[model samples]
Target: MATTVGVVVFPGTNCEMDAVTAVEGLGGSGRLLWHGDDDLSGVDAVVVPGGFAHGDYLRPGAIARFSPMMGAVARFAADGGPVVGICNGFQVLTEAGLLPGALQKNRGLKFLCQPATLRVETTASALTGRASVGDELSVPINHFEGNYTCDDETLARLRDEDRIVLRYVDNPNGSMDDIAAVCNEGRNVVGLMPHPERACDELLGSADGAILMASLLAAA
Candidate 1:
């Protein structure tokens, strides 16, 4: 059966199309999910695409977390469905409490857009199934609040639990432990600050990002 991946789109979400394109390109059916919809009925997996939701007002995803669709997202995740959050979507996951750690403003306090190198640290999760631990790949990131910050104890616990899924090779955003992506306790949900969907089209640059999305299809 073909896998159906739902790409949630909110106002100002610029990467929804890219995410949908990437999912369909990899032989999965891509479906658009609106923020107001409460049903995620037939989706095998979910993708929260990047963008400045709610105009990034009052904190990046603060307002978006309360959207009607988040209720469904939370239920879907609790039921063991896979969810991937890219860039702004990552911020939303954190705000929605689906993932831990809060994304803060970049240390330099600027909106940064550039390609970054990252090392896959855990392949045990569904999101990293196509990637082996220690594999390095380049992906693009564009955001102002991409810096990942959690309390010392939370950081320690994440490290101890091996939940840190991706680490920045060059540490662009001043994230603690160079964390670029992370997984939930169940390991079925992942949130990353980079634009992996943007990297899936080789014509744009590199295909490294395809592996992460492909991994989800494989798991589905």
Candidate 2:
């Protein structure tokens, strides 16, 4: 059977459908899981797509972290299931303490919505396992607070562990170390500022995201 990927849907999440469609297009089954629902329904993987969760009140992902569904996600991730967060979903992962670092406002304090070039830094994680290190991908990013930051110790550890999965070729958000994506210690959970789902189709400008999504499915 095809892998069943669960797309978490918060109140302000507008990209759940996109994520679901992308999963289905990749030959996986996609299911929408409501933020208020705690059940994962035995999904093989979980994806938290972009959009202002809880309207980004009190900072992005702050309020959304308390949603009932997050608890279940936490448990699912703790069991080493694959979880990928995109854009605002990346913020939520950090807020939920599933991933490290924090996403801040853009350097110019302006929202960014454009294509970005990212270099695959590691394929050890579930999200990028299908890619080779140094492989470049063209993906889209749409967010106002996508600047990633972390403490010196955390940065050192991430580097030492090869947990930094992706980096921007041309820094767009002033993120520390030009980081575009990162994975948890287990390598099962990953968070990134770019929207891979938006780049899954060639007609949408690029199909580079297919490689990443395929890796997730295989890992699941």
lDDT per model vs. reference: 0.91, 0.94
Model 1's alpha-carbon lDDT is: 0.91
Whole-model lDDT, candidate 2? 0.94
Q: How close to the true structure is residue 186 of candidate 1, measured as C-alpha lDDT?
A: 93
Clashes of each: 0, 0
Q: Which candidate ranks first by lDDT, i.e. highest? A: 2
lDDT of 1 by residue, 1-220 (tens): 7899999988888998899889899999999999999889989999989999999999888999898988899999998899999999999999999999999989886789999999999997768999999999899989889999999998988899999999999999899999999999999999999988889977979889999999988876
RMSD of each: 0.8, 0.7
Tell me the lDDT of model 1 at 141: 87
Among all windows of ten consecutive residues in candidate 1, which has the lowest summed lDDT? 124-133
Kindly list the per-residue Cα lDDT of model 2 for residues 20-59, writing each as its tens digit.
Answer: 9888999999999999999987699999999999999999
